[model samples]
Target: MLAQLTNVSLSFPDKKVLQDVSFTVYPGDRISLVGPNGAGKTSLFKILTGRLNPDAGAVSRAGGVRIGHLEQDLSDSASGHELTCMEAALEPFAGLIRLEKRLEEIAVKLGREGHASVLMEELGEAQRRFEDSGGYSFRARTEATLTGLGLPESLWDREVSGLSAGQRMRLALARILLEEHDLVLFDEPTNHLDVPAREWLEGHLKNSKVAYMVASHDRRFLDAVSEKVAHLDRANLSLYTGDYTAFRGQVERAEEEGWRRYEKSRKQERKLRRQAQDYRAWSEAGERAKRGAADKGFVSHRAAKVMKRSLVARRRMEEAAENARAEKPFEGDEIKIGFGPSRGRGLIRAEDLTIGYSPERPLAAGISFDLSAGERLAVTGPNGSGKTALLRTVLGEVQPLSGGAGVSPTARVGYFDQDHRLPARDVTALEILRGTGDETLARTVLGRMGVRRETVSKPASRLSSGERAKVLLTRLVLGDNDLLVLDEPTNHLDIETQDVLLGALEGFPGGVLFVSHDRHFVDALATKTLRLGIT
Candidate 1:
């Protein structure tokens, strides 16, 4: 094993986050850590990366093993903030580049008559070091990695600090790969990647010789990239030597066994109950025989003693049956979610409109199109291709095509954006909801989405990300909206919550136009998809 975690336990004050969880990372372990929100997936990664200490247990690594982690981690502070993706990736070899330049400077200085020969010889040694480290070819390798991740050549020179979240994340991955550590840990590596870019990343990871562990809910991604799947369930961890599909099959089988055992136990308990009833009948018969003897004037001590002993025996049998019944188990299947009332108008019509930040790159031009209501369209294309821009345009937050756009006037819209910037941060949840008019009605709506009364009183900033999402979605639910435009809305939500949202949306009456890279979610929700691209 390249790394081993043994009997690890971690806690926060009164809460035990992880207990006796252990797993191994071998030389070729391409594992995915998957679980619902609050499952300690991120916390586990922090411990593995040494940012946090476990309350108990020890972690050991093979001698001389080198590990590299992706750029998204909070603990990874680099000295190249001023550099671009290409430059940042090549910064590790900056020392060699400096040495190369110094060697040249020394050579030039040595050309003077007074320069020492010893200095010139030292320059030769420096040159050798630079050459051996591939000093001259580092830039090419860095550019290649960036390009493979879908970062355009033009972006190679842009300041990293000026890049968007997606671009920055892509750069981070490039830096990790260029570092060439023996093991690489990717924490939510697909956060900002588009579908194709994500695919490219999977290809690179699969081809890499370095070992890695990726924590993600993307089943297709895990299947595409990993040879081993490490599952986190019920606070227990287990590893399977196969792709995600196979591992999922294994889990299903285990759950099936649980179901069978549960049923068997239930049946046994029922049988014991029946046996106890029969024993009661037998005891009553003994009493009846004693009563009959007494009525006939034959009530002897021996008869009475025999009746009492038989009753005692019956009671013992009943106790045994009760014990067996106590061992019976009660288990229920995972909840099944289904939506009602799926029928709706067939189109979300938009009139002639132009959309863009500048005329040079209008997201959509004279965009006259209509999506059948309930049609699931995926607005896609390269970075800055305007998928999100189109979403904003439809939501009326941004300028539309010169002629303007329309949503059939009667079409109500439900918008879910990544930033959730629709509301102010300082306002209490109740105030925001009441902004729709009717404070009492707002509270009733918030409750359905899992937001409590106290949370409604707190400012939006005080609420958790999930809670914030709940608030926005709750508003959408309460409103009589007919069109839902979500902008990477699934970014921070757990799979189960996503499924919950999916359940609510599956048969929703309105049209859904959301931007996302979650294939499973799209598959589950999108009845028809729209692809965005340049004409």
Candidate 2:
């Protein structure tokens, strides 16, 4: 075992976040930590890294283990554009390079067979070391990782500072893989990644020999990369052997089996209780018939003891039945979402659109596509395929360049960006509704989405990100535009929430366009996927 967490518990005052979380990280273990949002997954990682102390319990490291963490947003960590991904990866090889150069210089001036042999040996060792550091093959590996992460080759030369938050995160993930470490932890590793990037990461993780723990909301990614899953719930950690898919199956089966076991044991206990009840009733009748005043108290007391012992046994049996029962997650029966037919008539058109950051060198050009009403189009490609940009243009967030345009008016479009608009901001949720004249109806809508009445009246701005997203989604429905465009809508939502959103989209009759890394959501909701690739 590389690391073992024994009776690890954490709490903040009255709220116990984690309770007795015990697990082992072995040499080849790839574990995924999962739970409802705010279940203290991040807290656990902090505890592991010594950033946070557990309220109780202890985490012990076995041997001298090298632990590496891929920190959030690493673009600036590299600090310069002079170093490419390959160069950044090979920083360790700089020392080896210097040693080899000195040895070669000394060997050139001395001409002895022994010295030459020694030189050759050292040179060979250095070369091997460099190769192992991924020096000669570093370019290919870096390029593959970068490309796999949906970054354009052109980005290889771009300043790390120029990258967006998501881009920086991808670069960080790539670099983490480049390093050799005994154990690695990834927190929300797939947050800004695309489908292809996610798949590539999954493949790398599957073939990896190192121990890793990933905190992620992407079920497909978890299913692909993890060999074991850890669920944090009710202040307890439960480990399930196998990937997410296997875990889900196992859990479902366990619940079914639990119900059976509970029923079986419960029935047996009931039978015993009935028999005991009958015996007591007969004993009482005998006492009444024999009513010698002297026998009354003694007989009554003996029979009462018998009844008490039987009841105790019955109580213990019921407790055992309860212990045997399984509590499984309850996926909602359905989430109602309605979208009207898009006002976009026969055609949705982009004419000769040249899109990008600057007018001097636009990202993509001559982009034109028509998505008509009733067409569920999916924009897809590598990470930098300008998918989000295209959606924005469709929504008129970005104006078309010279000689380019989206013919449809902005009013006809509704967009849900990759960064979901709904973040619990400080504004009272009531204000959020009142601002849009949706106050009177807010409670009903929120209740439908699983928000309680008490929760609805509070400020949405004070809510968690997921809660805010829920509120914004309600607004999107209120917007009631014809065309629906979404960007990475599934980013932070858990498996169950993702399912609810999927059900909503699948039933939506309006023209829909959304970009997501989730293959399951894509397959279920998309009518036709548009291949958006950057040159």
Candidate 1 worst ten-residue window by lDDT: 330-339
Q: Tens-digit lDDT track for model 1 on 241-264? A: 788889878877877777777677
| TM match of model 2 to true structure | 0.76
lDDT of 2: 0.71
Candidate 2 regions exceeding 4 Å error are 73-87, 92-94, 100-144, 150-153, 259-375, 401-413, 419-426, 433-467, 477-481
Q: What TM-score do all the candidates reach, one by one?
A: 0.82, 0.76
Backbone clash numbers for all candidates listed? 11, 8
Encode model 2's per-residue lDDT on 1-535: one tens digit a residue. Answer: 8888899888886568988788888888999998766678888887877778888888888777878776543633553556664455445346655655665665664555555666677767766776675556755766787788766677776766667778777777787786778999998888788777788889988888999999888888888888899988768899999999998898889777877766776676666566656655665555554454455777666656665665566566556545544444344344344455565464467777777766875667777677766777877877666887777776667876644556356435566665556544566665666554545565555555545466666775567666666666666655566677777777657676676667666665567778877787788778888777666
Task: Show model 1 residue runs off by greater than 4 Å.
Answer: 71-76, 99-137, 284-347, 351-353, 364-368, 402-404, 422-459, 477-479
